[model samples]
Target: MVHEKSCLIDVPTAEHPRPAAAATLLELMHAQGEVERLSEREQLLSSLLISVNAVLWAIDWETRRVLYVSPAYERVFGRSASLLLADYREWRNSIHPEDLDYAERSLARVLEQGTVEDREYRIITADGQIRWLSDKCYINQQVEPGKPVIVVGIAEDITEKKQLELELHRLATTDVLTQTSNRRHFFECANQAFDTACAQGAPLAFLLLDIDDFKEVNDSYGHLEGDQVLRRIAESGRGILRRGDLFGRIGGEEFAVVLPGCVPEMALLVAERLGKEIQNLSFNYEGQAFGVTISQGLANLTEQDTTLDNLFARADTAMYEAKRLGKNRVLAG
Candidate 1:
């Protein structure tokens, strides 16, 4: 049998190249360009991850292994990324004891819910500083089935935000001068206490106190001394009052206390104790020394009392009577 001869084409020289060869060279150049572009993009992403303030982390859910952690982990958590990668428990150890259970449970919820964005907790840094974090985590959708589930999260430092919130609350609810509850906050809390007492038939007492001859003190010793007296009285009241009692600066040179679970007799004792404490306080303006006193009106919850205003009115009347009878004493309404 005769075999057909296979056709052979001449190989192209460097000077005289074939069309296919040129096309292959062009495709190689294009691929090289694409690779360089990819490398540049990867480098840019790495730089961004390093520079960001938040910590980015990925972990194997089943194995409890840290797969990857960004450089920011060291800065934010004050721990090395290498340690975290070696064992995911490093992250747990950093979390505050009070928040550990919550942080873990919230992270686990990502398995069912696919995401948990409102995860906030406190962490103790390696330097022994406590910091707040707003951690948002999610399940990795790209994780292959039968392989360990992957979880990713970003934790942002929220310590400053929490501190600002606390300061704002203090400004809103606290008296700037005495550091006691402000008038609005005092009345709000007092009204709630009054309603609770009325509902449970619990004994409640209200005490209204005014610094005796406060304007005269301000005029005589100057307003600065008057302010000192107010602050001292507030400090004394806070020290003498029961733990559960509510105290506030209600008006100019006036303070009020809400005594829950205190009967008239016990309330009188509290008032007397507070009065004596104030009576003991002495002040000196330049070379001259002076003492201060308070007029207190104590009112107890009564069957006829329907609102805190009722108690306030009766206490106000009694306080005026105390002023009339002579100050530095407690009187019941």
Candidate 2:
């Protein structure tokens, strides 16, 4: 990515013309020679730029053999280009097992539509290392004598970029402390669940949780201690729940969980699991260990519901009832 300065321009030191006409002619000739050399150097640099960084490949349509592969194959695939040239199947084998199906589909679509499909795939090196590769291939539309319609491709290594994108999405959707879904992502997924359940006439449920005496915990200890309690409780909730559940921190001491394809009874069981887990939890904040409990509320999404607010209000009311009835139980409505 770093480069040294190139000598594309040369300036003469003299501010004025030479004393004699012969001297002027000599200066002009020298400048002309420098210009010609630079032009040739530019062409060489262009070739190196493509040869070093880009992977160029060609496939013979009639024989279905790999006709050409640049030397960059070793730099990327950790082996000689001749391996793939001898048999295209070797190249196919190098592709990731999971991505093979997608690549095949794209190839088929290209042959049928005569339009290139831009895609990404995983490649395995000679040392059994995996890398993310991006490919750009288009069909050669022009016809020529004694040659089949060949597919030309150029590829680059984009593993780092892909990793960064995945990391970003994870952070954007997950809570920093407990690694649970944040409020924004939770609502989006829960709404989708509602729509799907409505179309299928399936039942859905909602569970609301609130930490008992959270303010007292923060005041008796400190904000840091309170944060630890929150994290521990959130983690316990996540561990107790199933993958089909949607859990998120909705407020400082409040959380919401959605259960899809679940009725009121199953939802109550799930809420009880979370509450029991929290009651068993012991926090060691600042070396002072203490116990904590949670209150939960459950609601079933009936076919008559129109908006999320309707379900949320019922869950909220039930949670308050649980809190009023001594704070360590699940209240269902």
Candidate 3:
């Protein structure tokens, strides 16, 4: 049987031909031992890479061709190494469309800089599932200046980690009962919107809503009924608001909405609709028929407004005026 010559096992060639006649049994045995040792070492390295969870790959930088990939490529990317190696475009096409440009820029930077630290991106697997991957790359040395050099890359699956982080952030920022942004998150988002509106000189509006006689509901029924009332209000208000609107539960019975690109008149219309929606909701607990109402205040961004709090305070004052005038109504500030 003819054995393939490997870099690990040194085989004699024409220039260094073996002295077959004078070679002794012990010398042959030693050479055989050395070959076996090197072969085992090569096999172990191959197996180590194949069995690992992360993808290991090397690519020709100049040609943008994949040179080597471990078996984990198939496991992580849901594609056989043969397909990726055959056409590098297949790998590029696997990246998510939203992330493709960013991924290309990252690779270009690494190639230009000769090294890159960790970077995260998303890719679409063969089965059409989106997965997050964090990878790093470095150029291999020992190549001629003008010749094609190799790039070594390693990537690991970070989809689960990213999902967990998203979940944690949601829990931290979302109201548990209403499933809307909590007070802190609401201000965070409102502040950002305020900054954008100021920079672009765009019209923006704020609405502060409060459930009328909420304490009466809790006192007459129970906290559970009050919680149900709040949930129903949130759901109903969300249904009436536009997709671009930002609505959140700012207090136990108070909610806020930030409407981008909305003027004073548009904000008043939205406040009226939201108030009507909440007033029309019908909820029952323990066979008791009860009704609730809401009061809303509307305010628009003004040149005099310096901070989100200024707008919020104006809306809050108008909401209180609404509550004082009538239980179910909207007042514009």
Candidate 3 TM-score over all chains jointly: 0.89
The best candidate by lDDT is: 1
For candidate 1, the per-residue lDDT at 145 reads 66
Per-residue lDDT tens digits for candidate 3, residues 97-154, read 9999988889878767888866789999999999999888888886677888889989
lDDT of 1 at 162: 98
Give candidate 3's error at residue 305 in angstroms.
Answer: 1.1
Clashing pairs in 1: none
Residue pairs with backbone overlap in model 2: none
TM-score of each: 0.79, 0.77, 0.89
Q: Name the weakest run of 10 consecutive residues (lDDT summed) in model 1.
A: 140-149
lDDT of 2 by residue, 1-333 (tens): 998988764444578544577678889999999999999998886678557766878887667799888767778888778878898887788899999999777766666666664778898888998889888776776757776888878778888988999899999998886678888998888889888888898999988899999999999988888898889888888788888889998888888998999887778888887888899998776688898898888889986788766788889999999999999999987
Q: In candidate 2, which residue ranges exceed 4 Å CA deviation?
A: 1-51, 61-63, 124-130, 143-147
Residue-pair clash count for candidate 3: 0
